[model samples]
Target: MAEQTFDVHVEREFDAPIERVWAAWTTPDDLRAWWGPTGFSCPRAEVDIREGGSIFVTMRAPDEWGGGEYHSVWEITELDEPVLLRYIYRFTDADRNVITPAESGVPAEGIPDEAHHEVLLTAVGDGRTRLEMTEHGYTNEQTRDMSRSGLDQCLDKMAEVVSAQPR
Candidate 1:
């Protein structure tokens, strides 16, 4: 069967340099600080920055959100330092066991088990960076919408973290 596809795209401009923005994405500490939505917290993050590298993170929801940990992994497919990063992302259990969309509470009728995400960063001048992030293969419109909103919240947190850095 041909692969099904849908895309969620977001673009944001930051007042920091491209390198700083790249660091915010590539660095484990920075990722842990802002990788989840406003009410979620990332308590653990492990990253290997290279093509074929793996990134693992645990995002924990608050008690009001059911108080559980969501483990996710990213298998890096492409990398261009401070410029572009691409990967395939999927969910796993605490032990790193793969979790299918249906098992993870996502509608599985059309959605794929994994999604492809790409981030492109450009130095738009004046020490500023423009970030273009796209996640493709969402299959379901509602899932895509929810993901976009959560991603937006995460990026907002990232902006707050990066914007507080020393220039």
Candidate 2:
């Protein structure tokens, strides 16, 4: 039998330069400004931009959306300033305790404990930057679809942030 695979690829072009886009991702303050979906907010962000460093972020849902927080961690595997970033992502609790998808109220049928995600940034000339994000290792199609939708919304928020910047 063949193995099943699930992945998501999202790409977008920002009016801001590559440096600005990279800062938005590496700077905690800039990241918190637009790290989640429209109705979600990033209350905290801690980033260490290095090959072996880690990033932790707290995403909080609106009052109407259960009013809880979800913590996520990214173990940086590779970093090339303003160009490429590779990491493995995992969910955690408020105390930084690693948690499974079921523990976080997510269906656990095919969701892996950790997934590899990567971001590629390119200078598209004329002060524009192109970002390509890919995340994979999902065990089930449902989880992948849901994650893709949420990621799309998050990227939309990021675009809004980039657009408001002083070019």
Q: Estimate each model's TM-score.
A: 0.93, 0.93
**How high a TM-score does candidate 1 get?**
0.93
**Which runs in model 1 stand beyond 4 Å of their true positions?**
1-4, 105-111
The digit string of per-residue lDDT tens for model 2 on 1-167 reads 85687998889999889998988888898789888878999999999999999889999989998888888889999999989999999889877789986787655777788999999999999999999999988877888888899899988888887778753
Residue 141 lDDT, candidate 1, scale 0-100: 81
Provide the lDDT at 142 for model 2. Answer: 86
Single out the weakest 10-residue window by summed lDDT for candidate 1.
103-112
Give the Cα error of residue 101 in candidate 2, in Å. 1.8
Best by TM-score: 2
